[model samples]
Structure formats: C-alpha cells, structure tokens
Target chain A: MIRLERKFASLKENSKKALVAYLVAGDPDISTTLELMHQFVLSGVDIIELGVPFTDPIAEGPIIQAAHDRALQANTSLDMIFSLVEEFRSKDSETPVILMGYINTFLANSKALESIHERGTDAVLIVDVPGESSLEDIGIQNKNIASISLISPTTDNDRIQKICMSSSGFIYYVTLRGVTGASNLNEDEIQKNILNIRNSTNLPVLAGFGIKTASDARALSQISDGVVIGSVLVEMIQELSEKKDYKKIYNYLNEISAAINP
Target chain B: MDNLRDLPNSDGFFGNYGGKFVPETLMFALKELEDTYDQLKSDPDFLKQIDQDLCHFVGRPSPLYFADRLTKHYDGPNIWLKREDLNHTGAHKINNTVGQILLAKAMGKKRIIAETGAGQHGVATATVAARLGLECHIYMGAADVQRQSLNVYRIKLLGAEVHAVDSGTATLKDALNEAMRDWVTNIDDTYYIIGSVTGPHPYPMIVRDFNSIVGRELRDQSIEHFNAFPEAIIACVGGGSNAMGIFYPFVSDPEVQLIGVEAAGSGIETGKHAAPLNDGHPGILHGAKSYLMQDENGQVIDTHSVSAGLDYPGVGPEHSNLKDSGRAIYLAVNDKEALDAFHMVTRLEGIMPALETAHAFAALDHLSGKFNKKDNIVINVSGRGDKDINTVATMDGISLD
Candidate 1:
C-alpha cells in the first residue's frame, strides 16, 4: 500500500476524519509554496494536494484560475513541482502528497510519471480525464503513485461501479454540479451519492468542491471519509500574498482541520 | 479506406485519438448522447426528418459554381466552389446545429448550450433553438464577443442568452471550457451542441455525419457536372468540422485527394499561427487527443488568426489521425494570403467569401503549378463574408460608417 492508503487506514482506525488541504505550487512563488506545504502539515493536514498549475484549468472557478495564472507567471514546470515534493518528503515522509492538474500537463512531459514516482508522489488527480480511462492508457498504471478518480452526483450507478473498480487511493466525490468554488451544495443529494459509491467500493471517499467554511467541512465529513478544501485555501493564499503572511494561512487551515477532526 | 465507416472503434477512439476526457459529472450525459446518436443515425424516420430539414430549412444542395476567373488567374485546374456559404444563417454551421437540435428534441432535452468563437456557430445554434422553441444559451469569449459584435447581436436577436466568458486566454478554447462547465452543471435538462468535430467520442462522429452532406452532394454534383470525381477536395480546418464534413465521403475514394487549409496568422515561423497540424504535437485538449499548440509543460499556447473560427490551438482528432495516416494533405495559409484571396474572389467571381473559406481559396495560389488544366478541384466555401465586412474594413483602414 502507498502513503495515501496507509494514511486513510490510520484515519479510519482512529475514527478521525482526514484533513486534506490543497495549494497550487508556485502560486505566489515556488519558495512560498514550499513554505506552505510544511505549514499545511503543521496545521494538521493529513493529505496535501499540490496543484500542478496548467494554462487552462477548465474545472476550476475564477479564484483557482487566477491562482493558476500567477503560478504560470512564476514559471512552475512539472520538474519544479516534483522538486518541491522531494523537498517536502525530506522533512515529512509520512504525509501523503497528491499532485492534481489537467492531463496534458502530465502527458506532455515524457518523464512525468517516472519523476513523480521518484519524488514520492503518493497520488495524482487529473481533473479532465474521466474514470472511464485507465491508468495504463495514461501511461501510469505500473507506477508507485495512485491514480485518483472523481465521482459526481450525475455519475450513474453502472459508471460508478466501473470508476470505483478502476480507481486507487480514494474516490473524490465532487459535491456540486458546478466547477470548484461554486457555492451551491445540496448536502442530501451528496449524501445519497456517497452512500451509493460506498456500497460499490471499500476505497475511502473524500468530498471536495465548494467546501468553504469549517461548518461546510464538518457537514461534508458526515457523508464521507474526508473533505478537501481548495478554492477557500486558494482564495486565502491570494489574499495573503500581498502581506506574505504564512501565519494567516496556518491559522485558517488549523480551523478547518479542527472542524473536520472535532 | 474500407474501414472508414467503422472508425472511432467501440470506445470512441479514432486510432489513438478522441475519447471521453471530461469530468465524471458529464460522463452520463455523454453516454446518453452516444447511445441516442447510435440509435437515431440509422433510424430511417430520423434520417428522413433531418433530410427534409436540410432540404427545405437549411437549403441543401447549395450550388457548385465554377470559378472561371480564379481558374484563369491560376492558369491551373478548373476550380469549383461548393457553396456551403448559401446555407441558412450564412454558413455551414447550420448543418450540424440543425441535426443536433433534432437530436436534442428527440432526447427530450428542453435546454440547449453552445460555444462560439466567430459567432457563426452561436448564431446557427440560436436560430435552430428559436425554431424548435428550446431555451438557448451561448458562451462566447469576451474578446470574441467584442470583435464579432455583429454575430453576437445576431445570436441575441435570435433570443439566445449570450454569456461573455473572461477566463484563460479569453478565446474559443476558454469559451469551450465555460460551455462544458455549464453542461456539467445542467446535464439533466441541457443538450450541448458542440459546433466543431473536436469534442469527445460521439461528437466528432455525429458532427461529421451531419456535415457530410456537403461531400455527398458534391459527389453527385461532380459526376453530373464533370462526368468524373474532382481530382482534389479542399476545405478550411477550424476544429475541422467543415473539412471533415466534406472530407469523410472522399476518404474511401483513393483516386481523389483531400487537402485541409489551416490559418497561419502572420506566419508559422512567427509562432503566432493556429496551424496545429503543421506545428503541433499530439496531445489531449478539449476532450480529444489531437495536434495541439502547447508548451513543453503542456499548457495550451495562445493562437492567432484573421478568422476567429480558426484561432484555436488544437485541431479535430480525426484530422490528426488523417494527417498521421498520410491520407490528407494539410497546409497553412497566412493572413495576407487569405485576405488577398478574400478580395480576389470578391472582385473575380462576385462572391464575398467568409474569412475562414478564404483560406481554402488562398491554397489555390500555393497549388498554382501542381495541377493539370483539366483536373477539377472543389473548394468548400463554408460561409459568406457579410459578418466579416467590419473586420475586413478595419484591416484595410477603411472606417465602416
């Protein structure tokens, strides 16, 4: 089992909800992103989803798109992102690191999968590539990293079964119909889908998309194993970049962590 | 060539390209579309209905006119213009939109969504939605909305809601992303009418099928006019729908040559052009694996063109496959060449061709010495140029009052 599987197993054993925090690598700059990864662990984040910035992130909302532009302006390539993960792994070997981005970013670089495995990337979530596609087709099946799959309310039961069967690490259930940072969250609908997904597979299901407040995370935690806070953290990072205030980011994540764990 | 009909295999792949590379939220919707299209494509009743619409509504069998002046000027092959420009809504875009709107009606989808670059697709889609009495929404890049104001107005005048998208590069690709987001959110009630043959599995096939009438008509018309098949067929490649429409029927005809013209903004060497087939590598973009203009890190690069329709970083997957298979010849026509052809056609034949279609005309100059005088070459005049008059005027420094 990989670090993600081990982390989820440990979280389930302790009856604790996993706190997954997401930050775009090189959002303000690469150095700040490195500092924030360690800060994420300090604030009790169990799994860190480091976004490898691409030119077009269709699934994201305005805030994340702007963050992607900032990261691209800083020239954050896949190599630099892998180096960041290697540096983070040196300090904290236990925390699961998930690199999330579009498929082209991964497929463009010939050595991307090898570099990912070499740098200790525990999981990868390509937002555009659906569950119907296998890791083998994407040229990452035999690698050490787990290919994370996304499930949404619109996904039918038959496809859900297929997606669950192919997925590794965990199933990320998108809570809303819209893009990331969309405000509308139907908790009852999400609960029903999560139940169906849980019945299909034993893999831990994590709820993401539009989880803004601690209460939102707390409520989402009721339906799944964990909650991934992306747009909210990205928004905070954008706001904090002007001041270069890492403390605010730590405190914000601590609040979310406490809410999910409590 | 015999396997042309069995393409895209069972899993929506066109030989290592084209698949469902969308978020899971839209998977069921894509499957539904695929299933519905599979059933309806061969259904005699559905085919009959679409045929009637094409004949009476879209004005099918748009005349194939011989461009005498253009042919004489080139001192080469007898150039024939397949007049898709004469279709309703002033472009070949209606061919696919009309077919898809019928599918949407058959699927009982009450809402329709589309993305546009030059607004031709948006206008065509909106016109069909108005006729069918369905709610229509069009996503256009903010930059495109400003540049193509006439088309934007036409879409709005047709009663469709036009959303100005201001994300990414603020162009066709970004507008496509917004439309996908909208479709994912409203998958239950909405049917997305993708303008080009560039999306996931069933879309490329479906759009090509709808637009293939251009080639079917040309085949019959060519036999009637020339007593033989044209030596070569040419069309402009913007997401490659019009080209694919005209190219599909001829794929099996080994004796006939197929050529696709791409926009070379200033020049391919300048790195500003949108000629993906010439300069791009194979990669996945906009739900299909195709030739895309992207950086080493896989980020889509900003593309430029005189025609908004061709200003995208990627080409259709089938075009990519055709290029790889060496079945089709792809060439780039820079803005100057296309503009010169735009004027030449207007002055020579009294046909003001769409900027996109002008690229096909411009290729004649490049093929000046390659063809025999008796060899017939047919070019798809994909649209009329009225929507582009303002742009042409602006470029010529002639202020449009």
Candidate 2:
C-alpha cells in the first residue's frame, strides 16, 4: 500500500482522527518556531504543516501575512525549512511534517520541489496551485511526499475527480467560498460537499478552513475523514507571543485535541 | 519587536512598522538597496554629491510654508503646509525619483522605465533621465494623456518615450500593468523606478523611506511653528506613499492623529469609490493582499476616480496593516468635493494641486468643522498646480475665465 494509505489506515486502526496544524516557518524567531514544533507533536499533533512565507501569498489573510513578514525577516529559506524538518526529526520521528507554501519560494531557492521533498516532508499543499496537475506533469516529480490539493465550493465534479486521482494522502476540502480563516459555516452544505468528494475517491476527505474549536473539528470529523486546522493555531501563537513563553502554545492545542477525541 | 525608530537595531522595521514579507524575485533588489543605502547615507562622498545636486538640480529642502488664507477659508483651525510642490520637479515625488535614479546609475543600469497615472511621476522620471543622460521610457494610461496634455508634452521634450497603455480600465491601473510587464521583460538590463509605495515588497518599504524627508522636515518645522508636533497630519492616499512617508515618524506618538485621505470618487456608499481600507476585501492583487475592491463573487473589480492617480482598487499592504491596527484612521472624499478643493486651494492659496492632492484638500471640511477643534493640522501639499491647470480650468468652464 502507498505510504499515505498506510498513514490513514494506521490512524483508523487506532480510532484517532489525525490532527494537522500549520505554522509559518521562522516566524517570531527561528529557533523558537522549531522548538514550538516539537512541543506541538508532544501535545498530540499528528501532522505539521510548516508554511514557507512567500512575498505574494494571495490566498492568505492579514494574520498569515504578518507571519510571513516575521519569517522573512529571520532569513528563512527553503533550505532552512528542510534543515528545520531534519532538526525536528532528531527529537521525534513518528509524526509527519508537510511543507506548506507558495511555489515561487521553492522556485527561487534553486532547489527543485521533488529534491526538497526527498529531505523528509511527507506532503505539500501549494495554495495557489490547488488540485492543479502541474506536479506530475512538470519535469520535477516528487515521489516521496504526496502532493496535496484543496477542493473548494467552487470546484466541480470533473475537477474533483481529477484532484482525487492526482492526490496521494488526502484531498484537502476547503469549507468556505473565500480564502482561509473565514468564520462562516453551513454544516448541511459542507456535509453534502464532502460527500460529493468522498463518492469520487476512497481517499480520506479532510476538511480545512476556519476549524477553530474542538466542536467544529468533531462535527467535521463525523462526515469527513478528518479536519485540518490552521489559522486558529496561528492566532493562538500570536496571542501568546505577548506572554513570552511560546512552549505554552502547544498547551492550547492539547486541549483542542483532547476535546475532539473525547 | 519593540517600537524603536532609532537604529542600533532599526534592522528593517520603522517603529513597529516596515519589514520584508516578499518573494525571492525581489530579494536581490531589496538586499541591494539595504546595503547600498546604508553606505550612501553616511558615505560623505555620496551625500556631498547628492546635496550639491539637489540645490543646483532637483531643488533643496523643498519648502515649509503656512497656508494662512486657505486655513482661514476652512473656518475652523490653523493649517500649515509643507510646500513640496515648489520643488523643481513639482512634488515630493522628485525626492524618491532622484534617489532611485541615483541608485540606478550607481548600480550601472543604463535604462530607466516608470509607470504613472496622473503623469506626475512620469514627469519626475523624465526629469531624472534628462539629468542623468540615461535612456528613459514611461508608460501612462491613454486617458491620462488626454487629461494632462502638457505633462505629456513636457515628458516628450525631455526626450522620453511615453507608451500609452490601453489595458484594463485604460487608466492608472493599465499603466501599472504595462510598467510591471516592461520591468519583468527587461529585468536584466533595466531599472524599474516604481512611482509610489504600492507594488510588490521592497517598493512599499523603499519609497516610504525615501519620502521620509517630508516627515523629518515637517517634524522640525512643526516644532518651530506650534512649539510641538501638530495634532494631525493629513495626506491623500492613492498608493499611500506620501502618507506613509509623513506618518512613519509619528506612528508611535499616541497623541497625534495620523489621518489618511483616500479617494472616494463617489461617496463610499456609491460603490464607485477607491477607498481600499474603507471598502476593500482581502484577496491577492498585484503581488500582495492588503485591501482590494472585489466583486461579490470575489473577483477584483475595476475602480473609478476622477483623479487618475487615485484610480486604483487596492492599496499597499503596509497601509492595510495600519488601518487594521487603528494606528491611522482613513477618510474618503468624493469627486465634486475634490474639484471644489482644487479650485478653492487655487483661488485661496494660489496653489493648484495635482488631482491626487485635491483629495487631501477635499478633507478639510471633514477635518475642521465636523471633527475636533483646537487641533493643529499639517497638510503635505504634495504637488504643484502647474500640471493640473488645464484640469481646473476645464472644470471652471474657462481656460482662464
């Protein structure tokens, strides 16, 4: 079986919904961001989405934009993000790490996407190129990490099928019509949407975008394979940056993870 | 992290503002600027050269003046003006254009190209190209050419070619599309002197820092005039380069109100305005997401402002942050009011402002009569009326009647 399929089966056998959390690499401070990642996995985060901030992140809102700013200031590069993954591996090797960001950042670093994926990232979600078939069609094919794509309300059945065929790990189904971090919800609509995607592929359909609370995640997991939470985790980091100890950020996520499982 | 304007650790931010959040396309350009500018600032060699050039070439210190009659006309409070208009190229734009042109020359770039809306920046580019003996090309919307014919003539006389852009709305936005296209096409051999603090990364940061001259001069002048800083500083926001330039120095001074006037060509309620902070939704535009006017379907919508310079749908991301944080309050002024301010300032102060500056003039009523009184307001008279003489004359139903 494929590695992504294995990951899904393992989580299914354990009766645990995979918890995926994202943070822009090198935000606030580089060392602290890495340190916080180890803390997050320790607090039961199953997968990490380490975002590489691009100069132009059209899909993101202001909160993520500021995170991009802090990361760039610390001179975070594609190579640095890989080294960060390796550094995190030294402490913990079980949890999966995904490099999430724009394609331009990798294109600029002289490192091809496939080569960088070989450094140990388990998956990638190129926000702008969602469900687009460029990864396989392009000269550089990443064999190690599954290329994840997002399906939104705007995505049609034909495109959804294509995304599912191209997807390896899971199809990220964006819940809202707009960009990430929006607070609007329509469970009936979302349940129907995820069902449409699930009908097309046996691959797990993970829901993302504005999943802030355990109730939201738990509600989503009922219909979907799992839930991917990002902005809420990022906002939690920003709020606690004032408190000075970033290690405590994982504590916030710990509560959310327990409530979802409970 | 702490708001520090001073440098042992100014690093990249300006009092909790200014930092790089850009892609790698601009990293070379931004790093080049940071290193070279730090050297040029204190290099006694470059300073003496630019200072002498400013006096004999671009005009020095611009001027600090009191627009007393214009102040009295408002019927509320005293208004002091920083006469950036009197500068040789006719506005604060020359300050940035000159600095960039010099940097381009030092960096060995032989060709200079720019994008403009009202032709204010085009004239500045043409002026610098003439002084530096470099090849110059400027792209302006075809509509701006019809409106500001004399500026078109002036640029031609300076021997620069003006490419009439016909894309998008066939105005400022189109001109920017053409300019960016030109830069990307010729990145190896050309220097793209972006006109405002709007564009991708380094630009918003670079342009604001260069225009910081206006803020520095005003801070000293305000202390000289009112024995302290003014209660408020108002500037029209197109891309917000001028406002950021002046506002950067005062961002941390909690007592002073930093007012940014955006072009509400029609009232904000009319759905025809370019007030990014007031109405724009968050989405990717140009290269970054600050605020952008988008359709209900989430597609970016084209905007209209009688003033060509203020005719954009989105604003710089930095300005977006300021609006969100409450560090600055933005207000909008419509076309009729701006036209009225154009004629009013021309008649009262004998100064004709660029249509973009007229947006600042339109906010006087919003400032004096309606808002708090006993507040000293310093308006950056960003440009001269010379370019807008025909615009004002046509609106008055007389070409000197």
Candidate 3:
C-alpha cells in the first residue's frame, strides 16, 4: 500500500483521526523546515503537506501567502524541498509527505516532478489544477504519486463526482466558502458538504480551510476521516521560526491531536 | 491556418496557453459564466443591446483619422489612428466593461468587482457599474494607486470602493490576486469583471468578443477610406485587451499584418521589462498558463515599465498562442523610445497618447520603410495621455505645482 493508504488504514484500525500538518518549506530557513518536519510527526501528525512556494498562491489567505513569500525569499526550490523530504524520510519512513503547490511550479520544473516519488514525496495536491484534471493531463506520469483533489463548499453534486473521479489519497473538503485561513466555519454547512462528498467517493475525506483551535479540529474530525491544519500552523511557524521554539509549535499540534483522537 | 477564431478549443486551451487554472471553488462559477455566455452569444436581443450601448453610451465608431503629419514625419506608410482613446472612459477598457456589466446584470449578480493596473479598467468598471446601479468594488495595487491618482479619484467619484492592495510588489498582479480573493469570498452575489484578455477561459473569449468591435470597425473603415485592409495593424499589449480587440477580426486575414508592442522597461536584457514573450517562458499565473516572467525558482519576478498598465509580468494567454503560431508578431520597445514616441505624437499629430499607447507608436520605428508610401498602416491609439501626463512630467524632472 502507498504510505497515505497505509497511514489511513492504521488510523482507522486504531479508531483515531488523521492529523495533517502543513508548512511552507524554508519559511525562516531550510534547516528549520527540516527540523519541523520531524517535530510535526512526533507531535502526532499523520501526514505532512509541505508547501512548495510559488510566486502566486491564489488559494491561500494572507497568513499562508506571507509564509510562501517568506519561503520564496529564503530561496526555497523544488530541489531543496526534495532534499528536505529525503532528510525527513531518513528518520521517519512511515509518515506520508505530500507536496502542495500551484500548477506552474510542478509543470515548469519537470525534473523536480519526475523525481518526487524517488525523493520520498508520496502525493501532490495542486491547488489550481482541480476537477477532472489529473497529473497526466499536464504530462506528469508518475503513477506512484497520488494526485489529491479539493472539493469546496460551493461544489455541486455533479462536480463533486467529477472531481473525485480524478482524485486519490483523499478528498480535501474546504470547510468554508473562502480561501485558506478564512474564518467563520458553520459546522452545519461543513457536515452537509462532507456528507455529500462521502456519497460520491469511498476515499477518505479530509476537512481543511478555516479550521482553527482544537475544538474546531475535533468537531470536524467527527464529520470527516481526518483534518488538515494549514494557515494557523503556518501563522505559528512565521511567528516562532526565528526563535526556534519547536516545543510551543509541537504542543499546539499535540493539543489538536489529543482533542481529535480522544 | 485552421481558423484562429475557433481557438481555445472549448476547454479554454489556446494551444496549451489558456485554461481554467483557478481553484476548484471557482470551477462552478466559471461553468455558470461559460454556460450563460454560450446561451446569450447568439441571442439577437443580447446582441442588439450591446450594439446600442456601444453606439449611444460609449460613443462608438471612434474616428479613424489620417495622421498626415506623423506619416510625413516618419516618411513611410500612410498612418491612420484607430482612436479608441475617444471612448467614454478615455480608453478602450470601457468597451469590455460595458459588455461585462450587462452580463453581470443578466446573471442577477448584485455586486461587481474588478482589478486594475493603470486604473483605466477600474474607472471603466466603475462607470458601467454606476450606470447599471450595481455595487462596485475595484482593487488596485498600492503602487498603482499612488501613480494613477487621477483615475483612482475618478473611480471613487463614480462611487466605487477602491481597495489598495499592498502585497506582492504592490502592483497590478497583486491587485488581481486581491480581487480574486474578494470574488472567492463573495462568490454568490458577486460578478468579477476581468479587465484584460487574460484570466480563465470565458474571460479571454468574452473580453475579446466585446472589444473586437475595434477590429470590426477598422475593417469597415479601411474599405471605405483606404480601399483595402491596412498593410499592418499595431497595438500595445499589457494584458493584451486592446491589442486583442483590434487583432481578432484580422487574425485569419493573411493580407493584414498584426503587430503587438510590449513594454521593455530598461530593456529585456536588464531582466526588468514586461515583455514576457521576448524573454520569458511558458508558465501559469492569474488562472491561465501563458508566457510569464519568473526566476529559475519558478517565482514570478517584478516587471518594470513607465506605464503602469504594461508593467505586468504575464501577457494574455492568446498573445502567447498567437506568438507561438506565428499569426501575430510581437515587438518590444524601451521606456526611452516610448517617451520619445509620446512626445513625437503629441507634437506632430496634436494628440497626446498614453504611455502604453506610446509603446505601439515606438514600434513604428522598427517597421519604417517596410511598406510603400501608398500602403496604409493603422495604430490603435488605445487611450489618452491625460492620465499619464503626470508620470511624463515626473520622469522629465518637471513639477506641475
């Protein structure tokens, strides 16, 4: 089984929800990202979604966009991300790592994409290339790397199925109606959307976007198989990376993990 | 060869250049737009309404004047000006905005949002939105707001809210990003009126169709006046709306040459210009894959131009496709040449051109002696210089105060 499937299977068997942590690689610096990747898993992160910074990340809100800008300013490239993943893989081989970014960054750099599977990257979630588009559509042919698709609250029944038809790993259900880090999550709407998505695909649905606080994660985990924490954690990284306060970051993740699992 | 007008191939791919590369949240909205446009494109009533608006409201059939002195000064082909600057908003941008605002009303959208570079599009969008009694919002870069204060005040006077975007080089691209974010957040009642022949599928197609009135008028005027199609048609391309407008009708005609002038701020070699077709590679930005100026790391780089309108890092995707398929020729002109052309046109033709339009005028130097004296050449005078006079004065070390 792929690392994502195996990890989900293990989480299901243990009756625990998956906690996915996302961070922009090389935000403060490369070495810090490498250190945080390992720290994320230790704090009960089931999967790691490393942001390959692009010049334009339209899907992101200001918090994560700033993180991407900082990461790009630090000279982070796909090659650097691959090495970061490889370094993380050397210490921890069980956790799944997904590279999340825009289409141009992946398609324009074929050398980086062609070797992502070999470099321990398990999946790719391109924010822009969604709904009936696969990696193959863009001439990317690495079958080993699953292409994750996002389904938003605005997605209708027909599009949900179409998006799922081309998706793997899991379906990312954007809990809110806006970009990443946007606020105001109506649990009723999120639950209804996730249920509609579940009707279409057997693949695990991971709720993300606008999700903040342990209570939010725990509440969402009840409706979905897992939860992906992005902007809030990215905000924390931006605030604490310079101080090297890994424990504060790890503790925050641990609180969310414990909240969702318990 | 195979009908350039029939391009984008239903999926919005202008030969792998334009596509719906936006987030999944926007897919439904795009489909809704595409479906509505597909239904109304052939509707006679819709067509008639657009024509009436263009004729009465926008003051259409903007005169194609013979630039006698400019033609004599250049000592080349007979020069004609397709005067888009005479439109209601003082530029060709109003043509697309008028069409889009009608569509927004047709779709029952209550709020209209747009992004602007030089603030021309913002003012244009505001003008239409006010006429239609819709809530209007315009996102402009902080830098652009400072540079184009006249248009900024004009947009506000038209009762539109101006959101100054301060992120990502604080320019046009950043304004576009902020506008998209606003649209995403308010998707239900909001209709985003994209200002260029850029963005996802239907936008490029729709904007081109609306603005193609320029080319259609030129075709009729050419036969009535010059007795044949002009030897060459030239327009400045920023996001490529005005150029695409005038070039679309002539794209399939082999007799006419279509030339697009891009801004070469400092120069292409200095890695500061906005001429993506000349020095950049194919990449995706602002919801479409096109020729983009970016670093080797794939991060989009900042572009430079004295004209705020042409200082974007990416061109329209169709321009990229046209450049590749050899249907249209693209040339770059530096700031100095554009300034020279601006001054020359102001003095010789008694018509001051926008800095963006000046780039198209500057490109004429490259094509000098290429055509016979009797052969006609048309340049799209896309906008007036009223908004750019301050920039020109600043560059020349003059204070209006």
Best by lDDT: 3
Q: What TM-score between 0 and 1 does chain B of candidate 3 receive? A: 0.99
Error of 3 at A99 (Å): 0.6
Model 1 clash number: 0
User: Can you list each candidate's DockQ?
Assistant: 0.81, 0.02, 0.76
In the range A157-222, model 2's lDDT, one tens digit per residue, is 776788788877777887864445767767998999999998888887888887888889888878
Candidate 3 chain B — worst ten consecutive residues by lDDT sum? Answer: B1-10
lDDT of 2 at A145: 70
Q: How many backbone clashes does candidate 2 have?
A: 3
Candidate 1 residue runs with Cα over 4 Å from true position: none
DockQ for candidate 1, C-alpha atoms: 0.81
- Which 10-residue window of candidate 2 chain B scores lowest in summed lDDT? B1-10
Per residue, candidate 3 scores C-alpha lDDT tens digits across A85-198 of 888889888899999998888876776677788889999999888667888888787888999989988898988988899988999888877889998799998998898898
| Number of the top DockQ candidate | 1
Number of clashing pairs, model 3? 0
> Which segments of model 3 are wrong by more than 4 Å?
none
lDDT (Cα, tens digit) per residue for candidate 1, span B1-401 = 76765687877888878887888788888889989998998999999999999999999979999999988888889999999999999999999999999899999999999999999999999999999999999999998998899999999999999999998878899999899989877888999999999988889989998999999999999999999999999999989999999999989898889999999999999999999999988888888889999988888899999899999999889898888888899999999999999999999999999999999999988887788999999999999999999999999989989
Clash pairs for candidate 3: none
